[model samples]
Target chain A: MNLHGTPLSIVIFALFVAAVLFLSFFFARKAKSAAGYYAAGGQIHWAVNGISFAGDYLSAASFLGICGMIATLGYDGFLYSIGYLAGWVVALFVVAEPMKRMGKFTFTDALDAKFDSRGIKLAAAISTLVVSICYLIPQMNGAGSLVEPLLGLPHWVGVILVGAIVIVIVSAAGMTSTTYVQFLKGGLLLIFSTILVGFVLSRGLSTEPVGLESGAPRGEMTVQATDSQLLEQGYALLHTTGSLQKYVRDGTTTWWKREADGTLWRAQWTSDGVVNGVAGGVLEPVGRLRQIGGMSEAEAAAGTGSVGPLDFLAHLTHPETRIEQWQKQAVTDEKGAKYAVYTPKMVSGTDQMKPGVKFKVHTTTEKLNFVSLMMALFFGTAALPHILIRYYTVPSPACARKSTIVAIASIGFFYVLTLFMGLGAAVNGTVNPADNNMSAPLLAMSFGGVLFAIISAIAFATVLGTVAGLIVAASGAVAHDLMDRFGRMDLSDRQKVRAGKIAAFAVGIVAIVLGIVFRGVNVSFLVGWAFAVAASANLPAILMLLFWPRTTAAGIVASIIVGIVSSLGIILTGPEMFAGPYGLTAEQAWHPLGQPGIISIPLSFLALIVVSLVTKNRRVAVEA
Target chain B: MLHGPARSSGPDPASGYKTRLGVVMFIIYCVVYAGFVMTNVVNEGRAMQTIVFAGLNLAVVYGFGLIIFALVLALIYNHLCTRKERELNVTRSEKGAGA
Candidate 1:
């Protein structure tokens, strides 16, 4: 469902963004001190801070990616939500009060609290930047993806816009502005999502899903020798037009054409008037009913024979169910013809299982890699520099605890509503098969133009809120952790605050550039890497400091370094990164797998213990 | 100074009662965690399985986890609050005697 650029949505979105910016500027005046810039002068109300936690926590990936995944993959997408919420458990029980007590500013404050070690400060700062950048890439990308459809701007322009606005917000008031922005966005996100979910349930499950097409179906045709040797030998001219868009030498391509009336149809490649199969046979476009075993009454009642409500729900929740949807082409030739491929994969069930179901196949095996990725997200929340720093914005540790509980309630309710909204998108048949990021927007389109506009605008605010928070966190690390803490710069409060604002601008620009560069990758997938890195590099250190008596400064420093290196090394050298970008074959990648949480987390813990023990007596004598 | 007063009431039976409560809550948490894991494994990670008691499954799994978390937090807070109360009482009585 393509949005018609409705005036209502534009106005709503404009007002929302303008209000956020205005509020940020208002707060900027109040944030002259370093304390105000980095920690909101320790004056934000617990309730507001709690909601801001939801706002900061629920990024574009959570709202759009997870919702889209649920729309396409079913229960698997919800796994992200569950995993995300579960991480708060770690935050509430293990990290909250202590983090507030230990750290004065950034996550590095807590890590370097016991040691006062420069190594720990530097390592933690670097990890914070890396994870923040990784996390920023997806948010920026989501911003671009959102803008292209909403404002009809180029992807790069969207990235720049989000980057600029977020920088302005961060630079203006730092955490003070960021927190309020987040609180506003978080409240709006929940409120709007609740409204959207209400609309979804009212629509209910239809017998036949209706009105999903938004473009023309063009047939593209391509021919290449099936022989791998021949394909590698030379350039192969492949004819691709109509439904069979392109025949590629190396990869499979797929495409959909929109009819004049906006009825979207899939283009089928045919030989002898039959669709071509891998085995050289005709393939036909199977109607929805035939694909899911002739629709039942539930499907009929919904006026769509494609998929029944129960069946659709079942397919989503079932781990073994393989659902097919169109995805954008990864690589295309110089021709204007876009390439698409049809790939089949099993659904993820990890989202459906409650936390502590770690032993399930979904949680344990490589097939359920997304689950493992989510496990990192779940645990990573407490360790996030941005989030941990937010704890310090409150005056007392008790207030920190109170704020977390409030955040839990707010965040939890929103996640529950996401299920309804996602499932609604699935049955509404308004999903953008090519881009899951547009699921909520498209679902809003199903309701009406105004609803679509409102939801889309709200989603834009979501990006703004999160990006502001991240920029604030990154700025704090640079100005406070690096300069003041390590560099021994004797800057006044005003200078520190000014330096932080400058850092925020620089980080914002970098985020925008990275966002534009990584457009094709799934936002949620990218976020998973961020979570893994955060969990690996930060969680172990935090846990050890809070729980262990023997944790010394040297130990903390060593653990931070080991955790950062091992996680980054594993990710960079892992099959996914090396094979995709580094021009290395999958086999040539050094790591056995992509995820490093399972290994790096443990390694960090061990490194801390061993190093702390070895250096314990040495440190004692020095202090004496 | 804080510990000196707390030492007088430290051996109260209430401590034993609280420990038992802690043990029970811990066991409940373990059971709920195990049951959730078992459900996922047995169902092979399928959704919407009609377990015998209908809504009971959701109630048990979600309720148990939440209750455990809440209980743990409450226990910790209670312990801290009581200690503070005792300290405040001791400090007030000492001031009264000096007056």
Candidate 2:
């Protein structure tokens, strides 16, 4: 897709940034004390805090990444939605009230509440910093990419700009400004997504592709030719004959499918430089509805106008409905130059509603990987330092519980909308084959330019809100937990708040550098790694501390250290990293599994148990 | 009895009751979530495609059900816990008045 920011988009985005900065400066006076700076003076209303939770938690990954995944891969994307929501069950039920009651400012305070051991303080602080940094990398990188197509800026400029803005937001009024910013972002995101989904349901489905939906004529045609005939025509066959075939000639790669009559029907990429399709006259856009509820192209176009929620889902789930999914192919030309092409594959609606499209459960390793990822996502939320610190932002444990309930309601509602938005992108000719992350925004574009601008601005604000939260968590770790507690700096209240501001600046700079350095890395993958690390390193210790009376200080420390080291070690040495960033073959990696939560989480629990048992004689203050 | 200053010296009486209820709720949710994961794993997601309700497949129904169920459960838990906290505080205040 050729995307250049319209003048209208730039104005809206600038207004959004200005509004956020205004809020920061407005709230600056309220953050005079350390508590005010770190936890918004613990005076946030449960309702506002709840929405802020959604804003803080739903990063660019949830808005762009999941919608993109769902648009491309179907129901497998919703699996992320399910796992992420399930995690809140842990957060609300197990962690929220206890964390609020025990901690004053940071997650480390809660973990070290029972035991005043410096080891616990140091270990928890390190874990917080590690997880916060890992999570920040993806949010920062998402900012850069969102700015590129939304503002027409370069990658580095976007990263630095987001970093500077977030630092100001965090330093100016700390949690007070951050919370309001997130609340605004959350409200706008929900309102706009609901509107977009309403638009989608009203439009319904169409059998015709881009021309009917997007007003762009599709380019496709079928030429009857055998494999040998194609070879005679100077086309080099790349792969063949399942539902799709691939061939490359000159600088263009063409896609083919075998017809029932033993002939090949091909679609070629045009010379428009935007990955448009042009091959004879039968080709269409990369993604569209082929048939809806068994209706043919012309029939469905005339019949299926405007549908309700259940009716829309029912039509999509019909066995006769077929949605065109674009499968991307990475192929090399005759001179070995790499090129990406998309092939249209017609998938049955039933299969589209199933889980096998993206995550395959056929092999033993695949099953383990799927299970591991689910485990990470399910256990990760409560363990995250940013999420944990939010508990302290409320006045009482009951307020924390209420805030969490609100968060679950709003966030859960948003996840449900993602299903419709993703499916809308798929069948409405809005999927960008080159960058799946653009699916939701492009779908808004299909509605209107104004809607697109508003959605893009909300998406960018989503990055800002999440990044501000991360920097706060990292700063709290450095200033409150490590320097104040572990190092016994005995900082005054003013000094502590000033130290936190300085730390926020430092973390923001680091995030900016890392975001630019990892420019092309997938944001979702980085987020998944952060979840694995958080679940492994923090969840076990927190759970045991809350439940197990025999849990000693040494046990918590060991569990955290082991959790961090093991998960990071496995992820760094795993096959995926080896193949992707390390420039080595997957076989060269020592580790087999890509996800670490399955093993590391259990190992962390085991370590805590064994160490606590061994140190039972010297246990720290046991709960009465 | 402790090494350093803490927010409180010992666990409050109400926390024990709340913790028990929270743990039970967590385990209940875990069982259902684990079942969803196992269904996808054991049969290559074939069971997920079975039509369960309202012409929707099991995957969509179950996925949407999980999201809604979480919110419902959270609201229920909050209501129950809030009532319990109020009851305990009222009793404690009454006893203090008598003393």
| Whole-model Cα lDDT of every candidate shown, in order | 0.66, 0.85
lDDT of 1 by residue, A1-624 (tens): 235455677788788889989998999887898778888888888889999999998999889887887666554566666667767766776677666766777888777766677787888898888888878888998898888868878889989999998888888888989999999999989988988877655544443444433341111211122323333655253653432233344454333333344333344433322223344332321112112223355544454333333433443333332233333333243554333433222223323322223223543445344344644765688788878888878876656767887887788777776766776665455555555667788777766777788889889988998888888888888888788777878678789988998899888888988898888764455677778878888888888776577777788777877887887788888878876777678889885567777777788889989998998885422110
Give the DockQ-based CAPRI class for model 2: medium
Cα misplacement distance, residue A324 of candidate 1 (Å): 6.9
DockQ, candidate no. 1: 0.12
- Best-fitting candidate, measured by DockQ? 2
Model 1, TM vs. native: 0.77
Q: What share of the true interface contacts does candidate 2 keep?
A: 0.62
Model 1 residue runs over 4 Å out of place are A209-299, A302-338, A342-371, A521-523, A582-588, A620-624, B1-99
TM-score of each: 0.77, 0.93
Interface RMSD after interface superposition, each candidate: 9.4, 3.2
- For every prediction, compared with the true complex, DockQ reads 0.12, 0.52
Error of 2 at A586 (Å): 2.9
Task: Please name the candidate that would achieve the greatest lDDT relative to the true structure.
Answer: 2
